[model samples]
Structures are given as C-alpha cells and as structure tokens.
Target: MSPRLVLVGPPGAGKSSVGRRLARHLGVELRDTDADIERTAGKSITDIFIDDGEPAFRELERAAVAAALAEHEGVLALGGGAVGHAETRAALRGHTVVFLDVGLADAVGRVGLNRDRPLLLDSPRAQLKRLLDERRPLYEEVASVTVVTTGRSIDEVVQEVILHV
Candidate 1:
C-alpha cells in the first residue's frame, strides 16, 4: 500500500522537521508542499504573498498540495493554512492525518516573531494563539490521530506518528 500520511498543525508545530525524520524512519520520500510551492514559484512563500497577494498564494498552495498527494507516496507536510481550503480538507479525509498539537507558547518559541511565515507577521504569541484557536477545530475534525508535540523530542513524536500510521 502507498505510505501516504499528512501532517496537520499550526506553524512551529514541527511538521516539516518531524516529517523529514518520519519519512527517513519509514523509508519513504518526504514531500513538503511548502517547499514544492517555493520551488514552483521560484520564490519563498513570503515573496509569493508580497508580490501576488494571499489569495494568489493560496491558489498556488492548493495546487501544489493536490499535486503532491497525487504524485508522491510519503509523509506530506502541508503549510499551516492548507487545511483551510474546504476542498483540500475534504480530499484529506480517510487518509492518515496526524495533528501535531502545540500550544501558543511552544509555537511562539519554536518560531520567532520575525520569521518568513506570512501568517505570523504580527506579535507571535497573540498571532499563534489566534491561529491555534482558528485552526484547532479544523485540525481535530480532519485528523485521524492527534499528537501533542510540546516538550517532546522529535523521536518521540515520530514514534507516535508511526504508531498512528
């Protein structure tokens, strides 16, 4: 069977970091939609949003996410906002999705205020809280398994994800 897994969470929940390690442990390719979009656009996500606006960037992200699902069999780390797309969320149903849950403090610590993350443009603590509040329900609704990621080593999280997968 195809080893298809999706990692869902807000920024700084270690989706990309854990994803690479998980893919390594699982012996599958790691396909990160953010990286894919960056490569496709020939620019960073921040640049995409600045030049083309958020709606345009979302369009690009949606397309890249769908393409990754179609073309790859590996751990897929989506951008923090990718789950906001109803169609993409629908497509994720019945697949193995693990929500790497992180509180505002942890997320803020993991990602400083001056990062390239578009959504994290404001005060990181408040912004992270807002984002977590906004995306929390959506993540839970779509996830087959939820893993609390704060204070845990990457190996621990990877083990949990492997268990769920």
Candidate 2:
C-alpha cells in the first residue's frame, strides 16, 4: 500500500505536528523522513550536517524519503529540503502531496535559530526568507494542495488539510 497523504513544506510549516494529528484523525501512522534519518544515523539532523555535511545528510534524506514513500501506507512528512532534490519531486508524482506554507514571521517563531536546525543557525529570518524563495516553487509544483499555515492553529491546519486531502 502507498501513503494516503504526503506532507511537504519548509521547516516550521507544521508538517510533523499536523501530520501526527492528521494521521491520528485518519487512523494511520505518521512517517517522518527526518525522524527516519535521525534514527538511521543515530544522530540529530544538526549533528549529521555538522559531522557529515549537507550533501551526506541529503543523500540519507533522499533514501529515507524514497523508502518511506514506497513502503508506508499512512501519512508521510518530508524534511523541508526534500523537494529541493529533483528525484524526490519526481517520486511524488502519483501521491497526494500537501504543501504547508508558512510566512517568515511565523516560521521564525516556530523555527528559531536553534542549534538543532543546522540550516537556520545563521540569521533565521534571513535564512528562512531565502529558503522560502528557493523552495516555494518546488513545493507548489509537487503539491496537490497548498495550505497556508500562517496564523492558523494546528487544528485549523488539519481541518484545511482534511478538506483538501
């Protein structure tokens, strides 16, 4: 069986949170590629990035996403930069992909310049803006539905996703 819903978006877009709720609401398991990566590497994403670099982390990420997409029959949440890879986007072709869009303001609050988030370690606001600029189009391209998560609560976002998914 294939995933019933796949969530793709930038960090702080609430993919994991909404995914858990949506999965529970739908009575399905929630498979997060990031968590999968951490489990596989036996380290946090930041540690992987710092110890192994982004290229290495991305390779792991791509593999995890591919495996989850092929094997899971539930709600799947991809890492923020997963769609940056062409193969990941292509792999999403026949799946119900949802893009959770969040503005910089909300994103900064949700995803601060925390040590855990390697990408956002330097100037979170600016970095987030750049990330959004580079990745928004890609997210839109693969998304069957785009849910703006700015100012919306988790429940509200879940409702919107439920309506679309």
Winning candidate number (lDDT): 2
TM-score between model 1 and native: 0.96
Query: What lDDT tens digits, residue by residue, belong to model 1 across residues 39-149?
Result: 999999999998999999999989987887778888899999999899889888778899999977788889987569987786778888988999899999899999999
Off by over 4 Å in 1: 1-3
Residue-wise lDDT of candidate 2 within 1-165, one digit each (tens)?
A: 799999999989999899999999999999999999999999999999999999999999999999999899999999999999999999999999999999989998998767788998888889889999999999999999999999999999999999997
User: Model 2 — which ten-residue stretch has the worst lDDT?
Assistant: 111-120
Top-TM-score structure, candidate number = 2
Report lDDT (Cα) of residue 16, candidate 1.
88
TM-score of each: 0.96, 0.98
lDDT assessment of candidate 2: 0.95
Worst 10 residues of 1 by lDDT: 1-10
List of clashing residue pairs for candidate 1? none
